[model samples]
Target: MKFYCSIHEIKKTKTVLVGVPYDGTSTYRPGSRFAPQAIREASYGIESYSPYQDKDLRDIRFYDIGDIPLSYGDKELNLKLIEAFIIKLIMKGKKTLALGGEHLITYPLIKAYAKKYKEFAIVQLDAHSDLIDSYRGESLSHATVMRRCSEIVGFENLYQLGIRSMVEEDKLLPHRDVNMGLFDLSKAEEFLKRIGDKPIYLTVDLDVLDPSIFPGTGTPEPGGITYKEILSFLKLLRQKKIIGADVVELSPHYDPTGVSSVVAASIVREILLIMGN
Candidate 1:
């Protein structure tokens, strides 16, 4: 099913939503491949209007192009497919919003963004600093996705926020633009100033939210930013130009109440409002 408030006519909208349901590299939990449809189903439970932004989805036209077809066990081919699909959308000047199976999808999305915009910055909101050189002999895992993206778009342009977990090796990485343990508004402001007019690719891993409030992800980290706090941060980000974005890692079964999926849908609504504006 299409996301609530989405239209079927692709040519009529400036924003496009695509789902990548390939969680082949999820080392911890494997159900993220079901996230896209789950989020879509949950989207119907919320209102299209955003009281925080004073914007409504009804005012903006966007198309949800369903999930990308992926091979179950083929990581390399799937990444290539995602990259190629996104590159075509970028070339068409469509602002893309991706719904992910895992954070590893960000690597290909960033790669596609790099091909279109030479100067852009990545604003990552996650509970973990996914900067490992490699994880369990796999270089393209969700744990190492951002590391791969950093290689494509220099580390200087990558801004990571709300990171509460990381290894010793991650601590040694250069351009370590991370705010550990909490979301720092001052650091965010500084990065905004540095980004200036450059387009931003926002990647939000749902696990970034406190497990007390959101516990549907494979890796549930405690002591994360609250929902109100995250909404405030998104409101703050409204002033900047967001070229593309994604909301990843919501495994519905992990939370029997289905509240986590609704939470994800709410965040997607706000991000869509910002992108459409």
Candidate 2:
């Protein structure tokens, strides 16, 4: 089913939502490929109106194009296809919100963005840094997605928040700013001021929320921020120019209560409102 309140026509909206259901690079848990549909199903549980933003989905125009058709086992070809598809959407002047199969999808999405915009920044909200150079002999896996993206946009252009997990090697990488424990508004303000009016591409990995609240993620890290904290952070971005965004790493099977998917769907709603505003 389509996301809650999504329109049928893409030509009438500035915001376009698409799902990328490719998880070839998931190292630990592999069910994120099922997340796009899971989140869509969960969207029915919540209202289109967001009380936090004082906005309603019905007030905006957005189309859900469903998941992108991707073949299994061919990582390079899938990445190319994602990049090409995103380029088409960008060329049409649409602000894209992708429901990801894995965080690796962000690499291609940013690659497509790089082709159109000369300058932009990536705002990453996740439990892990995802800055490793390679994982298990593969350089393009989810573990290295941010590292790869840092190459395209430069390390100084990437702002990582709520990062509680990372290896020793990841610590050595030059990042513009990283909030290790939780989301800090002070540090976020610093990065926002530095970027000024640069367009932003936001990537949210659901694992950033505490496992007690959101346990349907592949790599669940403890000591995460609360749902209220996340909403507060998103509220901070309402005034910024968010060009595009994606919500990744939601493995619904891990949480049979279905709360995680609802959480993901709610975040998607808030993001849609932000884009619409």
Candidate 3:
């Protein structure tokens, strides 16, 4: 099913929603591949209107192109295929909102964005640092995705927030423009001021939220941001030049309450509202 109110025709739409349901690299949990459909299904439970932005999804003209047909075994091929699809949307001047199978999907999306925007910056919200050189002898797992993206867009251009869990080695690994460790919500203003008005590509890993509030993820970090805090941050981001965005890693079955899916859909609504403007 398509996301609620994502009824605009593809060819005539400026904003697009595409799902990449390939979770072949998830280490802790495996059901994230089903996140796209889960979020779409959960979208029906919420309204099209956003009290925070005073905007309605019904008023927006975005096309939901369904999920990217991805294969299981080949990570490189899947990434190439996803990159090609995003490139097509970019060529059409479409601002995409991708629903992911896992955080690894961000690498390919950022690859496509990097080719199009010269001054692109990545605003990543995640629980893990995702800066490892490789994981389980494979260089392209979800754990290493951000490291790969950092190489493409430069680490200085990456702004990480809401990171509360990481290995000791990850803490020592340093590069330009790298900001990790436990993030205080109060510093968001300073971080935004530092990044200024650059073309931004936002990647939100739903595990960044506390597991108590959103436990439907492969990796559940304990101390994380609240749903209201995320909304406030999105409002702050409305002033930036956001070219594209994604919400990833919501394994719906883990949370029987289905609150995680609703939160994901609501975050998508907020991001779309900001992107629409």
Candidate 4:
């Protein structure tokens, strides 16, 4: 299914919603591959308009290209496929709004964007630092996605927020980016303002939401930010230039109540408006 209220075809759109439906690298729980369809199915429950932004999806001409049919076993091939797809959109000068299979998908997405835009930034919202060099002897797992991304975009251009969970190794990582915890949010607007009009690839790991507000991810960290707080963060981001973005790591089955999917869909709607505007 397409996103709730997408209005344009792929070739004729400013923003394209491409779903990366491969969860091959998930270590904790393995259902995020189902997230794209789950979020799309749940989008119908919400309206196309956002009172917060006073904008409607009907005002924009973004396209939802549905999920990429990635292979199950070959993760290298899957990531390459994601890169190829994103390159096509970039070549067409279209910004991408990707629904991800897992955070690892961000690695490929950024790799593709890096080829087109130099000195662009990466803004990550997550519970974990994802700064590990590798997880389980594998460098390409979801746990090391940001590390891989930093290699492409550089740690100087990476900004992380809402990080409360991390391993001892994560803290010891010398190349960690400027990470902002819950308390640091008060200064977020200033930090984002310094970024100015730099092109940014925004990636949100839904687990950044507290388990109480969003419990459908593989790793649900406690003491996370609220949905309203996330909206505030997004609002600050509206002034910046967002070239591409992804909402990832929502394992719908984890929350049988389906509230998580609804939240994901709503965030997608808001992000789409931000990118379109």
Model 1 regions more than 4 Å off: 1-8, 177-186
Residue pairs with clashing backbones, model 2: none
Winning candidate number (lDDT): 2
List, residue by residue over 1-277, the lDDT tens digit for candidate 3: 2353434466677788899998899999888999999988988888888999999876777878899999887888999999999999998899999999899999999989888888787888888888889899978888988889889988777778887776667666555234552653566777788788778899999988988989999989888889999899899988898899999999999999899898888888788888888
Better of 1 and 4 by TM-score: 1
lDDT of 2 at 82: 95
lDDT of 3 at 98: 97
Report the lDDT of model 2 for residue 150: 90
CA shift at 200, candidate 2, in angstroms? 0.4
Q: Which stretches of candidate 4 lie over 4 Å from their true place?
A: 1-8, 172-179, 182-184
lDDT, model 1: 0.86
TM-score, cand. 4 vs. native: 0.94
Write the candidate numbers in order of decreasing lDDT. 2, 1, 4, 3
TM-scores, each model vs. reference: 0.95, 0.95, 0.94, 0.94
Per-residue accuracy of model 4 over 1-277 as CA lDDT, tens digit each:
2373334365667898888988888888899999999899998899988999999888887888778888889989998999999998898899999998889999999989988997898888998888888788999989999889988887777778888877776654543534444422555675577667888889999988889999999988888888998898898888788999999999999999999999999999999989988
What would the per-residue lDDT of candidate 2 be over residues 148-209, giving only the tens digit for each residue?
99999988888888887888777667753352334433366767777789999999998889
